[model samples]
Target: MRRLIFWTTVVSGIAAAYLLYKKGVPPGTIASEVIANPVGTLIHEL
Candidate 1:
């Protein structure tokens, strides 16, 4: 169960990043934004 949860979260995060990229967000911006403020980035994205 723990393993399943971990994979699911990993896949979901990847999908989220891909979607952001498809929307024209730069990869560097995404990485920097996530590193600087993860919670804020998630909130802004959602």
Candidate 2:
């Protein structure tokens, strides 16, 4: 149902935001880091 989809999206977005904060990463940092050092950034993700 439409209600179900809306709630799922809201919950997931919050989860993602919290995860990013816990990792000490601000949004958009990944893309900039990647351009500077692709391999290092990818390894850090793992």
Candidate 3:
């Protein structure tokens, strides 16, 4: 349902923000890194 999709998006966005915070990177920087290699970005995040 639409409500479920909206909630999922919101939760995922929050999770991503937390991950970026922990990694000491901004969301915008992560987004740009993702453009090069998503896997590398994830590894760097971890």
Candidate 4:
């Protein structure tokens, strides 16, 4: 259960970054968001 949510959040974050990349969002912004997103999600989950 927890494992599943963790993986899902990770995959979703990556997918979001990919979409942002495809939409021409800058790499620096995407990189920060990608790194921050999972930490935010896990923090919220707890």
Candidate 5:
């Protein structure tokens, strides 16, 4: 259960970074935002 959340967050972060990068969002900015709020970013993306 715990590991699930961890992996989910990891995949979510990677997906977010990919999408943002495709959209021309700066990598540095995406790194901070995704690192700062993985769950929130995932939920918001949903």
Candidate 6:
């Protein structure tokens, strides 16, 4: 059960990273967006 959770997290993280890369979004940009406007970002995304 724990192993399943671990692998699922790992796979999803890799997939997210790949998608972000394809979209040309830099990691620093994402970090700054979250840090600068967490609530606004969440609302906009939703």
Q: Highest TM-score, which number?
A: 5
Superior candidate under TM-score, 1 versus 5: 5
Worst 10 residues of 3 by lDDT: 35-44
Instruction: Return the number of clashes found in candidate 1.
Output: 0
TM-score of each: 0.59, 0.56, 0.57, 0.68, 0.81, 0.59
Which of candidates 3 and 6 reaches a greater TM-score?
A: 6
Model 2 Cα lDDT, one tens digit per residue, 1-46:
9998767655555555555556888668644564455444544555
> Model 1 over residues 1-46: C-alpha lDDT tens digits?
9998767656556655765677899999777765665555555677
Q: How does residue 22 of candidate 2 score in lDDT?
A: 68
lDDT of 5 at 17: 74
Model 3: lDDT of residue 46: 64
Q: Encode model 4's per-residue lDDT on 1-46: one tens digit a residue.
A: 9999888888877777777788798999878877878545334333
| Residue-level lDDT tens digits of model 3 in 1-46 | 9998767655555555567768788768766655555444445556
Model 4 misplaced stretches (Cα beyond 4 Å): 38-46
Model 3 deviation from the true structure expressed as Cα RMSD, one decimal place = 5.2
lDDT of 3: 0.62
Could you tell me the lDDT of residue 1 within candidate 1? Answer: 100
Q: What is the lDDT of candidate 4?
A: 0.72
lDDT of 1 at 29: 78
- Give me the overall lDDT of model 6: 0.60
Clashing pairs in 6: none
All candidates in order of lDDT, best leading: 5, 4, 1, 3, 6, 2
6, model 4: CA deviation in Å? 0.7
Best by lDDT: 5
- RMSD in order of candidates: 3.4, 8.6, 5.2, 5.6, 1.4, 6.3
Better of 3 and 6 by lDDT: 3
Candidate 5 TM-score versus the reference: 0.81
Better TM-score candidate (1, 2): 1
